[model samples]
Target: MLFIKRFLDQVDEKPHLSAVADQLREITYEQLCSRARRAARVIAKISSEVMIGVAVNKSADYVVSVLAVHLLGRTVVPLDSHCPISRLKQMITSVDLSLCLVSRCQEDKLTDMLQASIRLIYIEDAIGEEDANDNAESTRSVEEEAPAYVVFTSGTTGKPKPVLMPYRALNTLIDGMAKATEPRGTTLLYASQGFDVSFQEIYATLCYGDRLLIVTDAQKKDLYALTEQLSKERVTRLFLPTSMLIPFVTFSLYEGVTLFDLSEVIVAGEQLKVTPIVRRWFKSHSRCRLINHYGPSETHVVMTCQLDNEPDDWPDLPPIGQLIAGSDAWLLDERLQPVATGCSGQLYISGRSLALGYYGMPELTSKSFITHPLTQERMYNTGDICVLNERAQYEYKGRHDRQYKVRGYRVELREVEVAVLASGLVDDCLVVASQLGLTTSLILYFTAPERGQDFSLSLHSHLAATLPEYMLPSFYRGIADIPLNQNGKIDTAKLPQVGGVRPRLSSNYVEPQGQLETLVCELAAECFGLDRIGANDNFMEAGANSFTLISMLAELRHVLGHSFRQTDLFEFPTPRLLCGNVQRSKEAPESKNSIASDTKRKLRSAAIHNTHGRMRGRHA
Candidate 1:
């Protein structure tokens, strides 16, 4: 059955059941249906476009907008409101969007950023209209091959590519997920609307008569608040990116918070590592199970590994497990021939779970999606290297392009990351190869329990014991947190640059001399949770990222009664240099107007700081 019909059946069966909710409000099944119908009527009257864009924040209105588009048999093109205006504009043009639905809070801003030719409809206005008789049943017979939505990739290589998913593909995913696990009772919708995973979170829950809990932007950033909501709302099923699961579990365990209602925890979007903390978390919460899911945006979710065994028996690196129903997997060599059973090869996928090709880019689509030589089936090149184990399960080797050569030796970045994680010296780590003019340098970026603690010497000894010289990283940088993009995967672009003078790991601490230097050092120490910060220590080397630096600057502005821009950090990274600049600024004369202007600037800076805090809550 179509997901829309299934949802309508659910509404008819349980009219008063809680359907969807956010921080502000909660709505029942009947109310959600009514709102979707009203919004659909408004769209029918104003626009005839088939592709409608949803550019609202994470709220009940956002869900309503998506359902409204589906009611009219139109394709949804989700646009992230937090993305830059230029990027949004480019996406709008790329999909040839003529109409977009937005919330009243963002209408003015989007109107200015979007093209004048595009029509914007306010969701509040639609929902506020007089209650009308439902008339969308006729449109419920949407063709299975019709486009359901268009989701864009992160575009690490070049411009973001749009992948068009059909209704058949979505239905297959919903069925597979239902069979994988019986979803029930208040599942959290944590993924961004633009990401394909959001579809599973939204449709899979609603179609199964489960309540959907929408997380607010503020709650997402505050771990304490997020855990409180999870326990208070009795969320039964939760999905988190692999990068966030460790920290979330560790924090809850340390805080003595009990999520008695949570029964299942699903993680995806990266490799899953079974660290000691994870094993301990499962040991404590015996009722809750950990499910590791693996798939790309093109195929919503095709494989899963459910860890229900004893915590002590789990492997450090779990296999991605077998393919779900409605999907077929093929391990092929570079020449497109089937490889040996145990040998590693590029993974190819075909069957009902496959998406319709990339929208309007036939050349790129042909390059990625091709026909099998023997079976003559249309398959998508997953670009992931995999090997079949003795248990008939596929183990993920790194990506095809993730392998790089240094000093005439090939190195798999994932292997180095595994070694770093196994050392247990750091909480999280990411290893990447950096290219400079003609030399390629291996850099390791990591986060630890003590952000300011230097682990260079210990890590060097650990890697030297297990890995070869070429595989060892030349530079190591500690950060407050590993940066994650909107989709919850590691954001390599946000990693701090390693171009400046490398600080000696074993250097003697230099004490602050004057009051200005002392004040700077004290604030730095407090921000990073350290005993004291040396005047000559580099902020970046001392575990400072762009987000933390902005916050530190805002606090400094409030205390010193002087304004400092983010660029100033690049110019004077050390506390001694920063104090020197502050001393010079104090010596200059100030007028009454200048003081008033400074006060206004401080207020503005405070607002920006709050915004940054919200942005920091997003998982990479």
Candidate 2:
């Protein structure tokens, strides 16, 4: 059955049930259907294009606009509101989008960013109560094989490639999820709008007659806020990126709070590690199960491992588990021949869950989606290296590109990361290879429970006991947290520069000399959750990012009664430098340099406010 048909049936069954909600408002199934119908009529009058862009923020309106596009049998190209104008333009141009749906609040900003050739339709206007009874269903029949939506890749290698998903593929995902997870009261919509996971969060919940709770940016950034919201809302189902699982579970365990109402916690987008803290969390909240789902954007979700057993019995590194319904996977060697049982090989997936291929890039699509040698069937070449264990479950060894040669020794980055995590000293760790002039250096970036604690020596000793000498990281850096991009995956680009002079750890802490310097140190310490911040400590090296910098700037402005530009933090990264600048600024408040600094500060504030507005519209 068509997903749209199923959704409509759900609406008929539960007309007054809450379908989707954000922090500000809630909409019932009946109201959602009405809004979609209204928006569809407006879109039909605007254009006959098959592909429509939905650029609205994550809210009930965003959900309405997407449904309206589906109602008209048009493929949706979900655009991130926070993306740079250049990147958004690339996505729009790549999809050949002629019309985009924008929210009233963001219409002006989008108008300025988007080309004049691309028409912008206000979602508020489109869903207005005019012509309430107009026919919204498309006159043209939408075939099951026709494209349903387009989601772009992360573009780590090059330009982001648009993966076209057809209706049949979406159906496969919905059906598979229904079988894997039991129906619950509510599912948190934690993913960003453009992410493929958002589709699963939005559609899967609505199809199951469950309320979809959209998380706000503020809640998502703060662990306490997120957990409180989850408990208050009685959120039964939750999905998190694998990188976030450890920190989230650790925080929850530290608080000694168990969300007894939560039924399932699904994690994906990276390898799953069932650390001691994670096991304890699940054991305490016995009602909640941890499910590790594995799939690339090319195939929505193909395999899943559910830790239904006792937490103590779970493996440290859980397997990706068995294939989902209607999905088929094969482990093939370099020559495309099937690998022997228990041997590692590249994973290949073939089934209805496969996407239609990259939009407007036939060569790339042909390269990634190839024909199986023995079966002569179309299959996606998943670059993941995996091995079948004794239980017939697939264990994720590592990614094909993540394997590196260090000092003439083969090393899997994941293997090293597992070793660090097993030490139990750090909450999370990322192992990366840094290329120097003539030698490659292994750098380990980690986040520990106590940000002020220096555990480098202990971590090194722990890894040395298990891993070979070559696998050990040459340098260890403790960060405030593992940086995750908007999509909730580890943002490797945001990791600190490896070759630079390392910052002095807490052990070599230096005291502040003056009142101004002391104030700066206190603020830095509070922001980073460190007990003490040295006057000469580097900001970026201490795990300061754009968000943390903005926070510190706000606090500084409050206390100093003077505005400071973000660039000031970049220029004078240390507490000592910042205090010196503050003293100078106070002495010459009206100087020419001060005037110029004021102007730059205003511009920075405006830019930050704009970003904050977009964030407010998204999940917490």
> Clashing pairs in model 2?
215-619, 215-620, 216-619, 216-620, 217-620, 220-620
What's the TM-score of every candidate structure? Answer: 0.70, 0.71
Off by over 4 Å in 2: 115-117, 130-140, 155-157, 179-184, 402-535, 541-620
Quick one: best TM-score, which candidate? 2
Show the colliding residue pairs in model 1: 484-620, 485-620, 488-620, 489-620
Give Cα-based local distance difference scores for all models.
0.75, 0.76
Top lDDT prediction, candidate number: 2
lDDT over C-alpha atoms for residue 382 of model 1: 83
Tens digits of per-residue lDDT, candidate 1, 357-400, equal 88878888898899999999999888889998997777888778
What is the Cα-based lDDT of residue 550 in candidate 1?
41
